[model samples]
Target: MFPTPIARTSSGTQIAYKIALPVALVLWLLPLIAVALTSVRSAGDITAGNYWGWPTSFNLLANYTAIFENTPIGKYILNSFKVTIPTVIGSVALSCMTGFALAVYKFRANLIVFFMFVAGNFVPFQILMVPVRDLTLNMGIYNTTAGLALFHIAFQTGFCTLFMRNFIKAMPFELIEAARVEGVSEIKIFWYVVLPLMKPAIAALSVLIFTFIWNDYFWATVLTQGADTQPITAGLYSLNGQWVAAWHLVSAGSIVAALPPVLMFFLMQRHFIAGLTLGAVK
Candidate 1:
């Protein structure tokens, strides 16, 4: 039922694949290219309706520098790091334990609980905005990084648990059984056996969660405001004047905000790929 690999396909099919590859890649990168181009264009170029055309001048350094000088982008970046890192760590760690319990231990409510995690993923988050915002306000952390991160952790854990449970389930059950026979404690088995095997998954989940949380503009806006707590995603709006929008600076800030996740993917590219394709071959 699976599609044949391109390497094993007929010559005409292979040629078609080769011709389509670059076209698809360029199409995918087109918007990013536009954003990058916009980031370097002069403000005059933007004002004079030169978007998507050749730039009159490249204000590369000036545009980048102007953002730092004229805005609180630096603090916004720090706030993003503070929020994203903790959320990724918290969500993944919680998922590992929850997934392990659900996968390795047979309990009466196992499927019911697992279904609950999966169910949360289907709920539309936009609908929760009012209540989540009101809840945060009541907790007196309505505009804090911790509040934002906590909400992200709670929301993300559901998906992370779904991801990790499947990975753990695919693991050989004999390892846990053998550990039990050897008088090894359950926690030790998880630590020494399952967790070691879960490195690829952990790395993959970390990168995914980091990107999601970093790029989360909606909740960032809903849960927090101002440079003190806002992530780079929402803080980009702060570049606007009351009467005017600085599209050039906003584009530059967007490019800047996107860098961390891109760098993160590149840094963990190997593990990330491995995690995704862990069981594909078999």
Candidate 2:
């Protein structure tokens, strides 16, 4: 049961919704607007503690250039890409295989195995920090991009599998049966039939996982160190000075750090919406 459409609601209710929507939207975007404004602020304005006031002089180009020239933000962004791209590909690939198996096959312990993946999602990752750190250290991968990417793939697969499994299960299973009657092999059926149908879901999930891993600061801090391995999320701290926190440069870096995921979402927006709404009706 969906909520009543606003058009059919009472005039009072419709007016209330109209009034509340923009208010709530502005409230949500206030911090982001502040950050954008701060990014263009001059150091003189920052030194004067004029955080919320109109800019004395805009240093948009200067501040953006300074972060790149003065810090290892470029390397940090490269490292973020190194970690995030591989994690997205690996996690989604593994999940698709696991989801296909779980959705298409009937087997003893199927639910048990599916539950194992589902159960991992409920475990608070904070508890795994110490052990995971020790494991990565023991494996001599504590501060490497590969180690971080692999760890993310392992951790993210659980939720990805859950998402993919439900989507796959919602599909018509009779297609697989039709493929079988035509003497198609299982692998071909999956490759030709199922994979095409999965493009929207893959695009949507890639955007989701890219955002998740790209903006990840916790594990980025815990598992990696130094600009050589640190993603932009964690490396933004380097923009701060010892005697002074360079809020302007930090804000600029934040904006720069956000571009990839935002661009990714926009590029995949059509597929993303299609994937999410595919089965919502009927």
Best by TM-score: 2
lDDT per residue, candidate 1, 78-131, as tens digits? 999999999999999999999999999998999999999989977998888899
Instruction: Write the residue-wise lDDT of candidate 2 on 135-185 in tens digits.
Output: 999999999999999899998898888878888998999999999999999
Mind sharing the TM-score for model 1? 0.86
lDDT of 1: 0.89
The 10 consecutive residues of candidate 1 with the worst lDDT sum are 237-246
TM-score of model number 2: 0.88
Question: After superposing candidate 2, which stretches have Cα over 4 Å from the reference?
Answer: 1-24, 241-243, 270-282
**With candidate 1 superimposed using the best TM-score fit, by how many Å does residue 70's alpha carbon deviate from the native?**
0.4
Candidate 2 residue 106 C-alpha distance from true site, Å: 0.6
* C-alpha lDDT of all candidate models, in order: 0.89, 0.88
